[model samples]
Target: MRAIWKGAVSFGLVSVPVKLYSATENKDISFRQVHAKDGGRIKYQRVCSLDGEEVAYADIAKGYETEDGEMVILDDSDMADLPATSSREISVEKFVPSEQIDPMLFEKSYYLEPEKVGAKPYALLRKALEESDRMALVTVSLRNRMSLAVLRVREDVIVMQTMMWPDEIRNPDFGAVDVEDAKPAEVKMANMLVETLAGDFDPDEFEDDYREAVEALVKAKIEGGEIKAAPTPAKTGGEVVDLLAALQRSVDAAKTARGESSAEEPVQTSSPSKGTPRKTAKKTATGASAAPRATKKASVKKAPAKTAKKTAKKAS
Candidate 1:
C-alpha cells in the first residue's frame, strides 16, 4: 500500500521518521452522478455568487461565512501565515492506559512504518508501548486542523488512530429514551440474548453482501438476464407486548440460527447504559440489512486543505 503521509513520531528529542498508510478501507460499490438518458458523467462547477462566472480550481480559496452572511475569503498565503502547532510531527503529549481512550472518539486509523534511519527509535517506542500497555496521546495537524490521535502498537508496528474533539461528540440526551421503562425479566432475557450472540469479533466472518450483490447484478445484466433484487432477510413476526417473551424468543432464535442448543439457562443481566437510546427495528418493504450499507455510503464526503487529506482517494 502507498503511504498517505510522511512525518515523524516525536519521541522527546528523538524524531522517528515514518510513513503513514491507511489502516482501514471501506469497500463500497460506489456510483458517480451521471445523466440517466445519455449515460454521461455529471460534473459540478464552482460558481461564484459575487460574479456570474465559474471559479478556476486554483483560484478557489476558502471562505468563512459570518452570522450576517458576510464571506471572509482566505487565500493560501493568509492560511500559511497562521500558526501551526506541528505541521510535520506527531508530537506525543503523554501516554495513558489504552482502555482510557473512547472507541467512539476514533475517526481514522493509519499504519506507521519507519523510515530507514528512524527504525531503531520507532522499535523502541513500539516496545515501550507494548510493555506498558499504554497508548501515546499525540496531536497532529492536517487539513488546516489539529486532531487528537493515539499511538499504539499493533503487532510490531505503531498505529495511529485519529480522534474527534471532545465537543464533537454530542450529548445524546433524547428525553423520550430517558423515560423508557425496562422490566427486570426483559433485562435478564436481553442479557441472555447478548451472551448467546457474543462470540469472537472475527471481521472476516462477515461479508460485504451488498457490494457482492451489486457486482452480481451488474454481471447478470451484462449477460442479458433480469436484474435480481437484493436478497431481503426473512421478515420476522410483529413485535409482541410481552418484553420478556420477545427477548427469550430472540435468544432462542439466535441460538438456533447459530446451530447452538436452544437452552434457556440462568444468565446475568447487563443493564443498558443509562439514558442510551435503543435502536428499534422497523419493518420496511426492502430489508434492514441495507441500513448499515447506506450508513457507510452517507459518510462519503468531500473537503478542502491546510492543505492535504490524510486518507487516499478511492482508486479507480
Candidate 2:
C-alpha cells in the first residue's frame, strides 16, 4: 500500500525518516439514492440561505459563530499565522507503560515504516521499547490540528496511535439508580449467575448474527424467492422462583449441549449393509486370510442378437 504521510520521527536530536500507512479497512455494502420512477441518480446543490441560490466553491469562507449570532470570518493567512510548535516534527515527551494508556483515548492507528537507511535505528527503537516494556508518548500535527499519540512496538514493527484530548470525554452523571437498594438474596444470585457464565475471551467464537441474517435475506431476495419474516422467539416467562434450581438447570443444559457427559456417545461409521452384495473373502487351509477380489457380471444381448441367430440358422 502507498504511504498516506511521510515525516521524520524526532526525539531529542535524533530524527528517523518514516512513512505512515493505514492499518485497517471497512467492508460495508453501500447503496445510492435514485429517482424511483426514472431510476436516475439524485444530485444535491449547496445554496446560500440569504440569496437562495446555488453558491460557488470559491465564494465560500470559514466563519465562527459567537454570542448574539455574530460571525467572525477567518482568512487563509489568519489560520496560517497560528502556532507551528506541532507542525512537522513528532516531538517525544516521555515514555510510559503501554497498559497505562486507556483504550478510550485512542482515536486512530497508523503503521510506521522506516525509510531508506533508517532500519537500524528503527529496529533499535523497537528493541529498546521491547526491553523497557514502555511506549513513547509523543505529539504530532495533521491538517492544522495537534494530537497526542503513542509509539510502541507492534510485533517487529512500530505503530503510532493518535489519542483524544481528556476534555473530550463527558462525565457520567446518572442522578440515581432506582434499584440501588437491591435485596441481599438477589445480589447473591446475580453473583452466582455471573460466576457460572464467566469465560475466557475468545473473539473467534463470537459472530455478527444479525449481519449474517440480513445478508442471507438479501441473497434470497436477489434469487426471486418468496420472503417471509420469521417470528422472534418469545423469552422465558417469570423471574426465577428458585435461584439455585435455575442455575443447576442452566448448567445441566450447557453440559448436555456440549456433549461433555462421560456415558460414551455413539460412534458413527459408514459401512456396506448385509443387503448389499459384498466381495467374498478367501480363507486358506492354514487359517491365513486372503484379500477378496471384485466380481463382474456378463452383459445380456437384446433384439440384435436374436436377429443374428435367425440369420445364421437360415444360412445353415
Candidate 3:
C-alpha cells in the first residue's frame, strides 16, 4: 500500500520517522444516477446562490456562516497560520493504561512503518508498550487539523488510531419505559435458550447474504435466465403474555436445529377431571407420551357443550 503521510514520532529524545498507511477500506458497490429513458449518466454543476452562475473548482473557498447570516470567507493565507498546520511530528503526551481508553472513541486506524534509520528506536518503543501493557497518547495533524490519537501494538507492528473528542459523543436520553420485571421461571427459560445457542464467534461462519443475493440476481439477468419471486415469509410477532412458554419454544427450536433431542422441553398435561390444575411432564427418550393424548381427548369431549352454550347466548 502507498503511504498517506510521512512524519516522525517524538516521545523523549528519540525521534522515529515513520510512514502512515490506512488499515481498512470500504468494499461497498457504487452506482451512479442516470436518465430512465436514455440510460445517460446524470451530472451536476456547482452554481453560486448569489450569482446564479456556474463556479469553477479553483474559485471555491472555505466559508463560515455567522448566526446573523454573514459569511466569513477564508483563503489559503488565512488558513496557513492555524496551529499544528505545519507540524510534522506525532508528539507523544503520555503513556496510559490500555483499558482506560473506550473503544467507541476510536475513529480511524493507520499502520506505522518505521524508516531504515529509525527502525531500532521503533522496535524499542513497541517492546516497551507491550511489556508495560500501555498505549501512548499522541497528538497529530492531518488535513490541516490537529487530532488526538493513540499508538498501540498489533502483532509485530505499531498502529496509530485517531480518536473522537469526548464532546463529540452524545449522551443517551431515552425516557423511562413501563415494563414489568421478568419472573424467575421466564428468566430461567431465557437462560436455557441462551445456553442452547451459545458458541464461540467465528466471523467466517457469517456472510453478507444481501450482497450475494443481489449479485446472483444480476448474473441471472445478464444470462437471460428465468427469475422467480421468493415467497413472503410468515410474520411471528405479537403481544407476548406467556414469556416462559415463548422462551421454551425458542430453546426447543434451537436445539432441534443443532440436531439435539427436543424431549428435554417440559410438556404440560392437564387432568381429565373438571377444574383440575395442569402439571408438567417429560417425554421419554423416544419422544412418546400418553399424557398429551389423554388431555386432547378430554378437551374434545367438553367442546360440544361449550359451543352449544355460546350459540344459545348469541341467539338470546
Candidate 4:
C-alpha cells in the first residue's frame, strides 16, 4: 500500500524517521447509485443557495455559522496559525501503560515503516516499547487537523493509532434509562451460558457472512438466476412467559449453530468505490442549440435555375 504520510517519531533526542501506511482496509460489498430508469450515474453540482446558480468548487471555503446567523470564512492563513497543526513531526509527549488509554479514543490505525538510514533507530524504539509494555502518546497533524495518537509495537514494527480529542467524545447522558436489575438466578444462568460458549478469539475462524450473502445476491442479479427471500427467524409467542426458559433455549440454539457454521454476526455495510463529486461547469449565457439552424446546401447549381420557377418561389 502507498504511504499517506511521512514523518518521524520524536522522543527526546531520538528521531525515528518513518513512513505511515493505513493498517486495515474495508472489504465490504458495495453499490453505486444510479438513475433508476436509465442506469446512468447520478450527478450533482455545487450551487449557491442564495442566487440559485451553480458554483465552482474553488469558490467554496470552510465556513462556520454563528448563532447570530453570520458565516465566518476561514482560509489557509487562518489554519496555519493553529498550534502544531502543520508540523510533520509526531512528537512523543510521554509514555503510559497502554491499558490506561480507553479504546474508544482510538480512531484510525497506521503502520509505521522505517525510512532509509532510519531502520536501526526504528527497531530500537519498537524493542523498547515491547519491553516496557507501554504506549507512547504523540501528536500528529494530518489533513490540516491536529490529533492525539499513541505509538505502540505491533509485531516487529511500530503502529500508530490516532485518537479522538476529549471534546469529540460524546457523554452517555442520552442513554440514561432505568430498568429492572438482573436477578441472582438469572445472573447465574448468564454466567453458565457465557462459560459454555466462551472460546479463544480466532479472527480467521470467522467469516463475513453478510458480505458473502450480498456478493451472492449481486452475482445472482448479473447471472439472472433465481433468488429466494432470506429465511426469517422462527416466530415465537410475543410474550416472554418464562425468561429463564427463553435464555436456556437461546443458549442451546447458539451452541447448535456454532457447531454448524463459523459465520457469526450478520452486520453489513456499503463500501462503494470512491467517486469524484460532480462540479458545476461554468454556465454560458448564450445557447445556439435552442435556436433553429438554416440547412445550407449546394444544389446542382440549379442551372441558374429556371428564373421563372425561382422567381415564383421567391415571390411565394
Candidate with top TM-score is: 4
lDDT of 1 by residue, 51-133 (tens): 43445688878899999998899998898898765498899999999899989999999999999999899989999999999
lDDT tens per residue, model 4, 179-268:
458788998999999999999999999999999999878788968854332222223442332232233334434554456542222112
What's each prediction's TM-score? Answer: 0.63, 0.61, 0.62, 0.65
Residue-by-residue lDDT tens digits, candidate 2, 1-316: 9998878888777787889888777656556654343233444445565544445688888899998899999988898898755466777899899899988998889899998877877787888889999999999987668889999888798999999998997777976667878999999999999999999999999887877887888898868965432222223332331232233334433454556562221122344455633221111111111110000000112123453344334433
Specify the poorest-scoring 10-residue window by lDDT in model 1.
307-316
lDDT of each: 0.68, 0.63, 0.72, 0.66
* Candidate number with the higher lDDT (1 or 2): 1
> For candidate 3, what is the total of clashing residue pairs?
0
| Model 2 spans > 4 angstroms off | 84-87, 176-187, 209-316
> Model 2 compared with the native: what TM-score?
0.61
Give stretches of model 3 more than 4 Å off. 66-71, 176-189, 222-316
- In TM-score terms, candidate 4 sits at 0.65
